[model samples]
Target: MSKVKIAVIGCGSIAQHRHLPEYAMNEHVEIVAVCDIVEERVNKVASEYGVIAYTNYEELLADPEIEAVSVCTPNYLHAPISIAALEAGKHVLCEKPMATSSEEAMNMIEAAKKSNKKLMIGHNQRFVASHQKARKLIEDGELGKIYSFRTAFGHGGPEGWSVDGKESWFFKKNEAFIGAMGDLGVHKTDLLRFLLGEEFVEVGAFIETSAKENADVDDTAVCILRTESGIIGTLAASWSYVSKEDNSTVIYGEKAILRLEEDPVHNLILQYKNGEVVKCELGGIQTNEEGGQTTSHVISHFVQSIISDTIPPVPGEEGMKSLQVILAALESKETSKIITIN
Candidate 1:
């Protein structure tokens, strides 16, 4: 049982926080290399992990020992880095907002298909215990004919979380390519689709930069989404929750209303039409309150999928579909019309 040798491209916040630590913790993985345009950061991470340091991603991807890579770079670079990794015969675990565009996402997918390598996207919300259980209950007919869902992911902006605070790449349109929609919204979009087992077919959005002084990117956004089965909902993503975050979802059904990631103690609460209530304690998601201490199952899942020769739960295609919803919402915002997913 040889370990999967993996490298992480981009030694930024996410790489330092999730990919580097999680891969180091995985028994089936060996963090063999790390790359970042910033030499100091790359050297720091590689030296800490006792691995090779590469200032260029191309150089890092050249290693024959590296079986996979985690692309934790900015939004604009996800597609190119992922495509190069796949072409170099390496599996890729690209960060959320798989690409800046659906077309770019599709290119990444094509590269994976041609390479026959696993291309997982870092949409780890699907691994949340409460969300997973809710999906199961819905599928098991406990919820009964889900009508709508309202999901939101917001915080006090990326200033507190990003490595560079307010001046981070997150607020730069050229670097980020998007703001909260791609950062936080895509996570919810993917999670909602995963939970309800449906695709968003239409979108209407109101995106704005109402907060975050000097930041050109949208600090807040609200999108109206309709799924393939006519299930409609509002998806909100914002960095303007100055006090606390509201990373919660409520699903309405004919028989019950399921609340996810809302309650402090329960984590999930369900109230039936007959007045019966059930509270379930579930695993927490990585959030500002926790300073992201909770474990994300993404690394383990990627390793296990490779070991088992199976597809990842959040494959590139799945990520692309979810990303498309966000893309549509962006178009809707710009055009002032309901955009249909093609």
Candidate 2:
């Protein structure tokens, strides 16, 4: 098979760290171009990869040889750029919080259907080694009759990770829509859905902008989520972990309790009711901290799905389902009532 000619639509930190590098590592991928509103960033990335650079995404999409693209732009641009790329006969791998609203997400899905192209969202949490193993164990009845869980993803802030630092689009409501919840919370929601293999039916949340100054969006959020099977859990996303990052989940079940990313050496641990403790040294998850840049496996999976003409692991419909939970959480925060998913 010929290499899949690809382009990255935004030369942001995610594009620089994850998408661009991962795509280059894939033997079946050929990066044809890069696009970003910032000419310097785009040019630097294109030069590093020996590819063409364009400041306009529409112009980049006009190239007939580009087979796919990774949309690493701000949250507000995910749906529109992904929809346009799909309509232009190209596969799309858009970043998380796929859209600002459920309607936009649905529109992107419809566009993909109309174009008959694969649309994968960049929900990398589902691709983590520990997460995948946890899902498999639950599926194999290792943790029989799951009861509750507490999952959190928090860090110092995006100021350290994003290209623009403190002034990044992440703090701007017009660009990011929601702050920590959209940036980090959605990943936990998607992962919980994947691990439990059920949909979240209700949400009650408290979202606040208590941490970061000069930021109009929330910096911390805590949500109560109930799955369709009546399994309830707490999900927390924050940008105020000053000293270290916390990306961990603990699940309780009738047979045993499962812990993911909780211990430094052991990525997964299970303690049974009969005094048996099992520790698995699965690989660490990717994080913003030093020495945490492990392979995400998202780019490779997206590339393989396109090459094999198969559905991606996290398709647009799946992304929309996970996104709806966040949307419901927002509504719950506003109305001070438990919001039910339709």
Candidate 3:
């Protein structure tokens, strides 16, 4: 293993815009394969990166030389592919939401344990500099007994972000499982968990396909969460914002009210009760074609975890905690009552 030979298991927008570009930045990584169900996409990304391409993900997983695989596929396929990769003795970095359902997420976690291979979820928000700072502030007790937080991750629509335009798999429920919630909501849920440092104990939420007039899944959703430690919060996700709004996490504590993404308003902001406001810019500031290359940060973390035999920051079970919150939200939306995580 001169260098960690990695394979990308999806050639979609995320692979192109984030993962692959990030891998290119890491001197210790050699991206050996790019896989996708779509032949053209696989070939296109492979050509761009000068790597082998495969229409079948299993083919890439079969490659013994690939020490790790980044699972960038649709939400529905995440568990299956990552589990297979782990079983094949390859470290895995799975995209967020963790899985379409908590059961599936647990299966992936079990597979990682059985194989003793590293499994890291792609909760990139945790990697952002601003978020890292916020986590440190909270852990240091600067906020002092977090009471509540509100956050959101919304955009114009998947069409604007996906290479497939309106026809993107994001619009397909079978491929995406749940639309806006699974796509954007997961990010907020994971971020909230990361910042609060607690698992959600109960959730009550509402979901609707009010916008994106032609979509089958939810275009908007709002959820309320109560963490195990008595912290409360609201999380929102949508594909209807005219201008992208990725703002998030306003934590109110006994000593301070921390507002994230508050100035320039695109960046994270922290406000203290003593009337002090600290602003910090986010990492991976994508101002150009090279902006998304920081995705390698997450990949590098996964590789380091593998080499050191340490659990990943966003490990499978930890990711499952986030997914369980989402699933509880779904249950809450359907039943019109707060659902508990346990």
Candidate 4:
């Protein structure tokens, strides 16, 4: 099979750290074009990857040779760019929190359907080995009727990471839409949905800017969610944690409680009612260019899905479902009441 010629539509941190490197490692992919609003970013990445560079995304999308695109743009541009790419006869893999609003996310999904192209989102947590193993255990009846869950993803802030530093799109309301919840909480929301096999029905949340000094969006937020199956729990996220908390989820079931952390040791720990505890450690599913490494397993899955014409684990609609939870949480915060997903 010929290599999948992919055009990347954002040359930001995520594009550089996760997507680009993963593409370099994948034998079946060719990074053909790179685009960014900032010419310097695109130039640098194109030079590194030996691809053509474009300042305008439309120009990049117009290239018929590109088989797929990775929409790594800001939160506000996700839907429009993805829709355009799909309409241009390219499959799309968008970064998560799929869109700022449910309506926008719906439009992107519809575009993919209309175009008959695969649309997957970057909710990489589902590909983590420990998370995958625990999900299977629950499905296999090992957890025995799961009752509740708690998930969190927090970090210090995007100042050190974003291209524009503290003034990055992440801090701007128009660009980012929502803050910590959209940035990290969305990952947790999606992971819970995937692991628990449930849709969020309602949410009550307190979203606030408690820690990031002069941020226009929330730095810390907490949400309580009720699933379609009546399972309820909390999802917390922050850019305020001095010490970053890598994403983690805990599930309490009738027979046991399952805990998972992505840090120091990526593992699953289960405590049973009979006072027995089991720990399974699975490492190196992901990597960070620096000291910390996260799971890159999702990138491999994306490659496999494209090659096999299989549905990605985090498909467009599944990504939309997760975004709905985050949007619902924001709405819940605004209304000060439980909000429905519809």
The prediction achieving the highest lDDT against the true structure is 2
Ranking by lDDT: 2, 1, 4, 3
- Residues 1-342 of candidate 1: C-alpha lDDT, one tens digit per residue: 899999999988889888898888889998899999988888888899999999999988888989999999999999999999999999999999999987899899999999999999999889888988998999999989999999999998888888788789999999999999989999999999999999888999999999988688888999999988999999999999889788899999999999998887788999999999999987676775665545689989999999999999899999999999989988998999999998
Query: What RMSD does model 4 have?
Result: 1.6
Score candidate 2 by lDDT: 0.95
Off by over 4 Å in 4: 284-289
Global Cα RMSD, each model:
1.0, 0.7, 2.1, 1.6
- The whole-model lDDT of each prediction reads 0.91, 0.95, 0.83, 0.86
**In candidate 2, what are the lDDT values of residues 1-342, reduced to their tens digit?**
799999999999999999999998999999999999998888898999999999999999999999999999999999999999999999999999999999999999999999999999999999888899999999999989999999999998999999999999999999999999999999999999999999999999999998899689989999999998999999999998888899999999999999999998899999998989999998889987789965889999999999899999999999999999999999999999999999
By TM-score, the better pick of 1 and 3 is 1
Better of 3 and 4 by TM-score: 4
Q: Kindly indicate the candidate among 2 and 3 with the higher TM-score.
A: 2
TM-score of each: 0.98, 0.99, 0.94, 0.96
Deviation in Å, model 4, residue 124 alpha carbon: 0.4
lDDT of 3 at 57: 83
- Residue 155, model 1, lDDT: 91
Q: Write the per-residue lDDT of candidate 4 for residues 1-342, one digit (tens) a residue.
A: 799998889999889888888888889999899999898778989999899999999998888999999899999999999999999999999998888877888899899889988899999888778888988999998989888988888778887778778878898788899899998899889889889988889999999998876588888999999988899999999888776555778999999999888445648888999999888877733433257664466677887888999988789899988998888888888888889888
Candidate 3 lDDT by residue in tens digits, 1-342: 577899998888888877888888877788899998889878888898899989988877888899999999888899999989999999999998789887898899899989988999988778777778889999999889888888887878888778898888898888888888988898788888888888889999999998886688888999988988898888999888776455566889998888776555346666777788777666533321333434536777887787777999899988888888888888998899989889
Clashing pairs in 4: 285-295, 285-296, 286-294, 286-295, 286-296, 287-294, 288-293
